[model samples]
Target: MLVIGIGFFYLRPIIPFLQSQRAEATTVNKVKAIETLQNSDEFSKKLAAAALKRTAEDVEYDPGYYDIAYPGGDLPANKGVSTDLIVRSYRALGVDLQQLVHEDMSEHFRLYPQLWERKGPDRNIDHRRVPNLQRYFSRFGKVLNNSHSLDDYDIGDVVTWSLPYGAAEQAGSHIGIIVPGPGARSGEKWVVHNIGSGPKWEDKLFDYEIAGHFRFGPIRESMTAAADTKSGATLSN
Candidate 1:
């Protein structure tokens, strides 16, 4: 009877211990799965999309060139221009274009255009400029050929265009990020930009002459993966 009692006591503890171990194992697996998904390219696209959506929520459209601080500085969230869309989208992915562009411009100031006519790199406005971002991405990112084919660009890709303003043919640069999902127009991809109005997702991929096309970070790899997926499906079929 004593042996039976001891066995029962030990077995009861073992059952709870095994249950705890199984729960711990399940938790570890769940965490691992979450980490894997977070590291995927889809996560980056989702981050950019969320950023664009948030930007679109701000109805105020202020284009004033405010003198701001450096590094992590920013104007009022609601008050910004086209480049702010790019800055905030990439910022959502934890890729601070403001700091990245400022650092790059500081190292190679001469490489960037002198549109603002500033002597050196200004962190406050350098990243906020479309041309500076174009040059920065061209240098650091995979600069895709500016083509009319929509297949060339993918979600998370950055595109620039020239906007002529005023007389004397003074052209201004505009930038935007491509996002997935339904576009404003059927059979067209959506773009998040602040063109005069606040940030919005529109089917303006070819609205202006594409001055630059770039795949920054892991966007290119994601495009390749998507392409591979399509190819694999075709082969299987």
Candidate 2:
């Protein structure tokens, strides 16, 4: 009886410590798994670079409200905003942001902001708005930190920043895609955006207060299988 009591007393004190160690181990394993998934396929990265490179030719910045078609609809090739750079880049990779955003907002309208007081999803401009895109990315894509670390921002990663001025009650938001730089800046990444001037590559990534960071590809289950084939592991959505 003494032996049994002593053994129970010793084990009882260490049970919580063992549990804590197990929890730590589990977390470490999960992080490693996600790390494996984070290294995306090279094709997507190359496609994003190629698409951003094409924008430098003549992408004029224009933020006018236009009534366009749904699904594959877009502004004129010459005119676009910061979000257009992202939309066009993804479109170059066969991922239609317009259709994807519309479909997601349609199903989860309540999840998106009702800033315009609109009752339903507006396909004409919902996909073009920065806030909407940010929310969509948060819901489906891998949400990243707003850290100063360059390693966190990868080629093909989507980043959002807040502008000083804004329309309506909300602060203005801008979005861009990470791409390669030139000359000395080549080692560090640059951003492709249409911040008033037009679609251009600049090393102004940390210029504004970063609002959101994301990796948005294959967010849905159907897309995950195809993504896994190239990435060699399942990515976190």
**TM agreement with the true structure for every prediction:** 0.68, 0.71
The weakest ten consecutive residues by lDDT in model 2 span 226-235
Q: Of the candidates shown, which would achieve the greatest lDDT relative to the real structure? A: 2
Question: Against the true structure, what is every candidate's RMSD?
Answer: 18.0, 17.7
Backbone clash numbers for all candidates listed: 0, 0
Once fitted onto the true fold, the runs of candidate 1 whose alpha carbons sit more than 4 angstroms away are 1-40, 166-170, 183-187, 218-237
Can you write out model 1's per-residue Cα lDDT over 1-237, one digit (the tens) per residue? 999999998799788777655433233433443344345567546544544455435646555556664444567666677887777666555566767787777888999998767999876678777788889888888899899988887766888888766311215678888754342122345677778767766667898888999887733322221211111001111
TM-score of model 2 vs. true structure: 0.71
Residues 156-206 of candidate 2 have per-residue lDDT tens digits of 788999878862113578988876554333457677777877776667889
Per-residue lDDT, model 1, residue 159, is: 89
lDDT of 2 at 73: 63
* Residue 42 C-alpha lDDT in model 1: 74
